[model samples]
Each structure stands twice: as structure tokens, then as C-alpha cells.
Target: MKVIKKMSMTMALIAASATAAFASGQQAEEISYYEPGASIESIVVDAAGKGQVGNWGLGNEYEVQALLTKYGQPTTYLSQAFDMDGFDDDSILLASAMTYNELGLVKNSYDGGYSYGEGVSYIDMNDEGVAMLEDNLFTTAAFAAENPETVKAFIYASMKGWAYACENPEEAAEIVFNYGSSVSPEHQAYMAEQVKKLVETDTMGNMVRDYGKMDEAAMAQTLELAKTYIKLEDSVAASALEAMSLEDVMDASYWEMAMGSSGAFSPEKSEVSIQLKWLPQSQFMGYYVALDKGFYEEVGLSVNIIPGGGDIGETTAVYTGQVDFGVTWVSNLIAANAGGMGLLEVAQVYQRSGLVLVYKTN
Candidate 1:
């Protein structure tokens, strides 16, 4: 698996490669890992083959614009201009690919051509050098300073939640759905399974026992790419973002504290809320499972799980201190950091990018 992954990563950097990403619960069984890069390429090429433009599978207008800039925007880029209704029937030549959920919708769609022989044509953002970390836990530096123990407890509780979810994805899926995930029950389950793969392993296919450790190297790569591809509104903002070092963006002491203490969770008690990136979904199953299973309570936290929506932005809410902690993508954080928001990452949930570029293969 290591050899294959290294080869895949090398090939992808040179040009592009047809890769397939698949996720099913391990369920006491070891499943083969997919090269995230190849899987992404297959999906993108599939969409492009059919004459569609490509972009990130998720993000708002601002983030999407950043994605286009990062990818060397296609001349026909128009994801927001048209919805998914008649994209396949018309000459829509671009579509954002999300490996975890939306891209799955395409493979299951009527008749999209594929690049990986029986698979599809796409490109993984990670491979294309635009891989940004997603679903990271973050908070304002003031909170960390005011309540260092509280920070440690939350990290411990959250890591427990993720570990449990990865090991028991079906149960985790049910928890996410019941927590108000707007997606169908089946879709939630699919997301649960995929997220499990990410939280449990590194991109190289090795098991990662440290559940919430931030990959500093990957984080650095994310920052560099964001600087190149994303343009901040003002030069000052852009300069601030470019000036940030990983130390400014991350404070790992709390995570280390959590790692040092491994006894059964026992806490006096504290209360706080965490805002998620979106409404209830399997992508955030770990936190939900923690809340549902009382892991937060075990760690002495009385957590108020705030669901995210149209008006509820994770980075903004965290920056304003509206929530004690927030779940968000690393790219958004970079944008905010560049714009003078002093948000810091506490825990990294997903080890790999689920975002991909999908296009028509025909």
C-alpha cells in the first residue's frame, strides 16, 4: 500500500492519474485504501470528458472563487450560474466533485462516462497541490488562555468521539441523522463510513492511533497554496495571511495535555457550545457521537452543540467568540487569518481532503 501510494502521488504530480476513492465501514475487516489523488482525478476527468467545468465539490461563493483561482479557472467555469438540474442533459462542462457524498451521487447517476476504465475521471485537490485540511476544531486564542484545562478536556472528549465513530460507523451514522442531519439517512451513513477512513489513517494508508493530531506539513502546504490561489480583499489582509507561520495558526499544547492524561474521563463540569460547518451530517459524526454518548460530560464539559446553516458561518462565529469552539475547513481559516481573525486550530478531524474536481467523462 505504501509503495502504491508513493507511486500514485508521484504520477499525479507529473500530470494526472485515474484514481478511485471508496469507503465502507471496516466492521472488523480491513478494507483497501484508495489513493485520494487518483480517485479525485478520475472524478474530474469524468466530468471534463463530458464538457463540463470543474471546481471544489463544496464551499460558498467566496470559497468557490478561491477554488477557481487555485485551479487556474476554466474559461467556462459556471457552477453557481447553473444548478444540477439539466447539467447532464445540456453542455454544462464543469461540476465540483465531493468524494464523500456529492460525487457518489454522480457515479450513481444515469450514464456519466468514466476515466478509470470501469471507474470515473476526476482529480483529488490533495494531489493537485490544493489540498486543504477540513473539519478541524478551532477556537479563539483568548478562550485557550482563559481556560487551558477546559481546552484540554474538549480535545480529549472530541478525540474519544472520533475514535468511537470510526470504530462504530453505523451507530455513529444513526447518531448524526438523529442529531438533525438534513441529508437522507442513507447519505448520512455513507458520509459516516467515508469520514471513518479519514480519521483513522494517514494519506499513505498507515493507521494513525493519534486521533486528533494536526499534520503540520499538510497544514503548511495548505497555507502556501491558499496564498498562491486565493486573493484576499485587501493587500493588508493578503499580507497578514502570507505572514502567518504554523505556530501562529496552531497551538498544540492542549492536545498534548489531553494525550498525556489517559485515565477514564472524569471532570468537575463546564459548559460551552461548538458551531459546526453545516447542519447535522455524518461529516461531523464524531462530535455528535461525543454529545450523544456523554463523552463531553465524561471530560467535564457540558457542550451545547450548535448546528450550522446558511447564516451560521463557522470561522466567523468562532472569530466573534459566538461559540467556544467551531468545526471548519482549513482553507476558510487561512482566509480568515489573512483577514485579521486570530483563530487557532486545536484539533484536526479529517486527515485527507474529501473535496474533489468532477467533470463529464463523455
Candidate 2:
């Protein structure tokens, strides 16, 4: 594990020395980002040239906003209450589905049973170059400052859980399946297997030797996507683009503790809550593994894991202090920073982008 050299500056710098630095904002330094680790997670939007232009939404996900911007498609934001697969069967021209979740639903259609492999043309976000980071652990700058040790404990346990999941994907998938409410056993299992490729590799398909390490180049690219595609309602999300140095926004000091004390799990206690970006699934198998393995308890902490959904805003909950921590995408957090929320990336769980695009081959 590499040493994470964290700056000791506190959030007070925001109103004090940091204020001066922002006021004196000069020529921004050329950010030369590092691309390490390899993960296969990518979010892609499905496209079709053969059908009519009528379409609905990808549950109005904030992530869908980026895909929409990239594809330049007209859309209607609708409720998930409608059967997504029904729309597909009705010949909706273009739509988006997650590689881990929705795509599988269509592929293994409960009704018509049309598999994605039959007639679908898929566009991988990484292949299309509109990808963004997903499933990163974050906390407010103030929370990190006040609870550094707690943060480290959570990251440490989570890293262990991630290693376990990467090594034992089938078991990991079962864990996710048990957590399912609206999801299917087969789909959960499928997500578990596919998500393994994403969690174990980086955006460039390079093998990620370490879990929870930030990929600088990949993250920088993600910021660019947010600025261009996810700004929403004519908002540029400039703060995401003009973010402070990596050292300022990503606090890796906790990583050092987890990496150093590989065998010695903390027994001293604390309590915290982590709100995941989406519902309980293989995407967050690591966190669940940690909880199942008693890693959180071993770390001397009691953790409340909250599941998120399309309607749930992890950023808003975190900003309002609803949770001590939150799991969200890279763009979401950076844009939150732009909105003055001060959410900082503590650990990057998914080294690759999970965004994908699907289209008809005919």
C-alpha cells in the first residue's frame, strides 16, 4: 500500500487562510492525474437508429443526465412505477440501462424473455469516453476533520471486505441477493459476477492491484464529464472543474492506517452511518461483506448502512448531516463541492466507471 500523505489543514481554512487562497485564485495548475488500477465498471446509455424517437427516462437518475447530454437525445423523466421492460417491448427508440442492473432485467425479461445478447448494440461509456467514477466513500470536510480515526476504521474494514468480494465473487453475490427487495435472485447474481470485473479492475481495463485507491487521471476525466454533461439546467458545475488540489479534496491519511495495521483491527468504539448511492446490491458488496464479517465491529465501531435509490439524494442527505458518510459517484461529490457542500472523497471504491450505453443492432 502506498503512503497517503495528507495535509493537516482543517476546514477552518475555508474561512481563514483558505479564503485568502480562493481570493487569490490565479492560473490553475495543470493537473497531471495518475491512472492506476484496472476496473471494468462503466455506465452506458442504449441508443437505436431504427426505431421511433419516443422515449421515457432511466428513472430520472442524475447519472442519466450525463448520458443524455452525451447522446444529445430528447427525453421524458418518468416514474419507475411504469414497467421499464414494457416500454422496451413497445419499441421505445432510445433508452439507458445500467450494466449491472437494468440491462440484465431486459436481457432476462420476465415477460417476453428477450436477452440483451440477442439484438442489442451496447455502447460502453469507457469506450465512448463519457464515463465517470462511481461508488466512492465520502464525508463532509468538517466530519472528516472531527472524526479522522472513525473514517480510517471504516475504510480499513471496507478494504478488507472489498478484497474478500474480489476474491470470492459468488459468495459476494449471494450476500447481495439476500439484501434484495425488488431485485431478482438471478439478476443479483448476475450483478455480483459483472460488478466483480468492475471492482477488480480500472477504467482502462488494467488490473487494480489495490482497493480504495484513487485514480487521478480517471477522476479528472470524470470531473470533465460532470462539467459538460451533468451540470443540469444550464449549470456548468465549474467548482467540479476548478477543484482544489487532490491533496486538498481527497484525504488518504486513513488509508495509511488501514494499510499499516493490516492485522490489528481497532477495538475502540465509535458510531457512524454510510448512505449508499443506490439500493443494496453487488455494487456495494464490499460494505456488506465488511458488516457481515464483523469488520465494523472489529474496528470498534457500530455502523448504520442506509440504502439509496434513484429518488434518494446522497449528497443532500450528507450535507444536511443525515449521515456521517455517504457513498456517491465522483461527479456527484465534485458537483456538490461546487455547490458549497464541502463533501470530500475519502476512498474510491469503484476504480472504473459503471456507466454504459445500449442500442439496437438492427
Using all chains and alpha carbons, the TM-scores for the candidates as numbered come to: 0.76, 0.74
lDDT of 2 by residue, 213-285 (tens): 8888887777665555543442444544465445545766767666667545443338788898888888888
Query: How well does candidate 1 match the true structure in TM-score terms?
Result: 0.76
lDDT: worst 10-residue window of model 2: 26-35
State each model's C-alpha RMSD to the native: 12.4, 18.1
What tens digits encode model 1's per-residue C-alpha lDDT throughout 126-245? 556556677789998888887777888899988889999999999999998887867777777777887887777655456778988888887877667666656666989878877878
Clashes per model (N, Cα, C within 3 A):
34, 21
How accurate locally is residue 171 in candidate 1, as Cα lDDT from 0 to 100? Answer: 96
Against the unseen true structure, what C-alpha lDDT does each candidate score? Answer: 0.69, 0.65
Query: Which regions of candidate 2 are displaced past 4 Å?
Result: 1-83, 109-114, 232-248, 263-269
